[model samples]
Target: MRLPLGLAAYRALSWRAAQPAQEPSAPRPEGALLWLHATSAERLAALADLGQRLCAQRQGVNLLLTVNAAVAPTEPAALHTASGRVGPVLALTSDHPGLIRDFLNHWRPDICLWTGGDLMPNLICMAAEQGTEMILADVNAASLPRRRGGWLSDVTGPCLMRFDAILTDTAETATHLRRLGLPGRRIAAMGRLSTGASPPPCPDTALNAATQLLAARPLWLAALLDHDEIAPVLAAHRDALRFQHRLLLVAVPADADDTANLIATARDNGLRSADWHGGDPIGEETQILICDDSGDLGLWYRMAPLTFIGGSLRPTARGNTPYEATALGSALLYGPHVADHAAAYARLAEAGAARCVRDTASLAAAVIQLSAPDHAAAMALAGWETVTESAALTDHLIEMIQDRLDQREAAAHARA
Candidate 1:
């Protein structure tokens, strides 16, 4: 495929190849390989989530994540799932012809999901020449890449023509793409893609056993607890206990090794505590269940109707995302320090599915109020709805990728 004049000029002037990646990846494995490129940091998480969903559903799908960012992250590493290393996460700094050639020749992905549309003419044109099934996702006027050669006759339009499909973030973006001469059939408005993950698995046996043992006690979990949060959390639990004596607080330390210290802290605060690993029954008198790891945090989310995300309460920025808890039907209580996951928490708060607790007093109050079975159930419903808001788009992507893989497999067999 001959490059357009703009791309030709870009190729001519593009002498500086991409830097040698710091990490060495294993040779590409056999089977369908999906390459997802994020044009910036904000778009990376959604692609990463898509990778995780694919891995969970289809056992052997290979994923490679690349980023074309203004700056490389301080550290770049492999994108790992529970099974193991999915693939290398590369930061593609330059799009010189040589760099693009080496990348396409070496990786030779079965399909490409080019996200946020910082269109790399060299990369896209070369990959299309190789007959790679390319899809540009979440394209908007705001996200389109503008380069030096953009002033010349048409890099973006001709370059985008290489894609098999273009998914825009809004109908307005679809119109924008049409203005650039892309056929309507190739473009669709799929609102902002989600970083939706499959809910953490909870074995039926474990869930049933925990349910029977607890016997429907009012339960809440303080997940990913930091060292500094120990006193305040236990105190909150103690205070909430006055109103709801049957309340159970499941405290999981951020570090498994801190289990002993948390237990000691509970004892010092005159609260009854039992280690989950200690083989002690969670009787009515057991005020706190000290869990060592958040590994089984899924089970706790199922057992408890409400959860307080940890890092938020500590003297730091936001806690971990509450999506996991929401996915598993748990309402959320969090602190004001939620910079990391501000958007997610903000959504939940607006929906009344989550509360932002300012201190020990507020945390205790929220636990006591939200623990009502009806109230918690309502919030959990809202949370679950919020998490699944982007389900239709997610399902479509999964199905599309699956169909792409199936086509590759069938084509290979036909050739054989």
Candidate 2:
């Protein structure tokens, strides 16, 4: 007869646990452990920088990063440089259990973070045995097959039961974990980490210039545009023109070539356009300003009262970040394909702070309707309120970690 499924799963878990731990050559001081499951080296580097900032904020805490070895050498190298400045970094070969074990043994971190993908059973078991706090942040597991198969059982279920806490990106995920047997008290619905990322300090000159250009005009932002979004965006711009002649649309291209196409499309639609590539001033007649610079989305979001997050209009794009616009006090609009930032956008929409458009015509109609001065101002206010309301999640996570640390110290003292 075949073994019962639960029994078989339990046996597998036990067998994996019985294997000898990977041993490293040298012992290092215990510190806060951070495991970066980054989708790319660039993202890993960004997380490492944030880790450093967190450590600087709180003294007596050391951060050690374990990154995927499969990440491109250049990206890992960038993380290496950043980690060196803050703490130590260990890059692990993907699927290499022994190397991962050895690194875990050597670092002996107080807390283990899993960010990019599903938590592996072996890793979760190891962290549990060591009494380390485990958390998964900014996670996206929307692929329906993965959800149905329940691949996270071994790691997420038992490990979640063992760990001090589990902070997830969405209420739906928290509900799923509860159904899997994790205690409700132990689960907190924290939004994406990218929401908490610090915005760059705004330059007074740029802020003044942007404010002056906007100068009482009904301004809106169309950010991170994919190739197919250009024509529809142009249509939306024209629709907005029916209500206001001084309407301004700022186009932030996802790629360099897209910028040219966007400008050409705007010209064809009967609007004068200018590119910010050469740092030219926005002339009085310029209706669309193509902003081609990287990392300036924060500034642009702040400058506009209402913003449409691009990449959602095209099915190929996974959607850009809406939290940036929300955080910067701009009301948001997006398309249907925002699988990546779904939770964030959904929350804002439910709060009446955002709207979702199905296609070009719907997008144009929404733009024209929202361009009303009072309506735009109310939506902007609602968006800011939603952002501030969610701010408690970060504080709640921090308090939980501190409580766990205290409990660990008390247990250690009792043992002595």
Candidate 3:
């Protein structure tokens, strides 16, 4: 029987099924392998952030990210891969048993988590049979694609049963899952699986060295700055420098490709600056320190007490999350374009952790005001508290994973 979609869908499935399967040569690490799946790029980004949180909670844990080929993860996951923590990404093809089994055998995943609505019945059921604890999160049945003959429920029912827990984004999703034979007790109406992430680890030696070198200097970070943002950030620095000649700007460009241009721009602004990637020092004469390396955000987040999260001052791009800056003890100054993380930013604003700036003038004024030790410390404390509150959700997810893993261990012990 031809599965419900159209000829195009059938051909796509056939092509995927025909692809050869192979056991990856990469050695599986000692700990559990978290298999995370997401259908869209946005969900992939959320999963990447979640994976980062999970790894932070458990030492030496490896994550196996699986996303649809069309929505390959780039930014944050690439960042983790570059840091040598996350394992090589596994691009899933078809729901073919052979392909899924080959991947499971090679990676030996201990747990599996799928986000969004799409369901691959064979793969999910096989994973459950192999004793992998499976979870379906952020489920919304309305978003799930329907087949021409209403065959979706038929195929999804048994596979839904295999999940250890089903976290629904709405009561409707929970109702649908319950109708499909998932027990009411195993399903809960949890919101979206997205959560703020912890700051990436920074080397202590580097952090200490930078802290020591910049001692007593009024320093602030222009974090994840873009090329267009160079002018405003530099202008803000210049404006702030008038009052405090000892002020230093730690400018981390969003794109490393912009470093040379950023350096030129800084010089054009009549500011003495050093490029950290090029082994330049943060001298007393240096007005801006260009952090060309992206990986050292953790270090900079810790070094600076006040940060202007870039990519927001301009209208073209939304800003990066302030959670990391706040988590690492930095009071935030962001532009009005923080729609991407509006909820997280709103909580920060409510807690007096972050202040929104409309232009270079406002940014400069906010920076100068936050540069004061007493005021900055209080904002940083508020930001930290906000981050801690967000951790309640993370802690809940962690507890679920731990309980499932512990249950498996106990079962094995009883069998022995």
Best by lDDT: 1
Worst ten in a row by lDDT for model 3: 74-83
Query: Per-candidate TM vs. native?
Result: 0.82, 0.62, 0.61
Order of the predicted models by lDDT, top scorer first: 1, 3, 2
The lDDT per prediction is: 0.80, 0.67, 0.77
Model 1 pairs whose backbones collide:
none
What tens digits encode model 2's per-residue C-alpha lDDT throughout 1-416?
Answer: 23345434754655564444443544565644444444444345445645655566566566666665555453544455556665555555443345446656766777766554434545656665665677665554451113347745433455445555666768887787677776888777776553333454577788887787667667788988888988998888887777777888888888877777887898889888878766766766778888886567867887888888988988767786576687777888999997656656776788788999988788878888888868877887877776665346545545555565667668878999
Q: What value does the lDDT take at residue 189 in candidate 1? A: 90
User: Which candidate model has the greater lDDT, 2 or 3?
Assistant: 3
TM-score of 1: 0.82
Clashes of each: 0, 0, 0
Off by over 4 Å in 3: 1-33, 40-63, 73-83, 105-108, 147-152, 179-181, 200-220, 224-232, 239-306, 310-323, 326-390
The reply for model 2, stretches above 4 Å from the true place, is: 1-13, 16-53, 56-107, 112-197, 276-284, 399-416
**Model 3 / residue 280 / CA error / Å:** 17
Q: Where is the poorest 10-residue window by lDDT in model 2?
A: 139-148
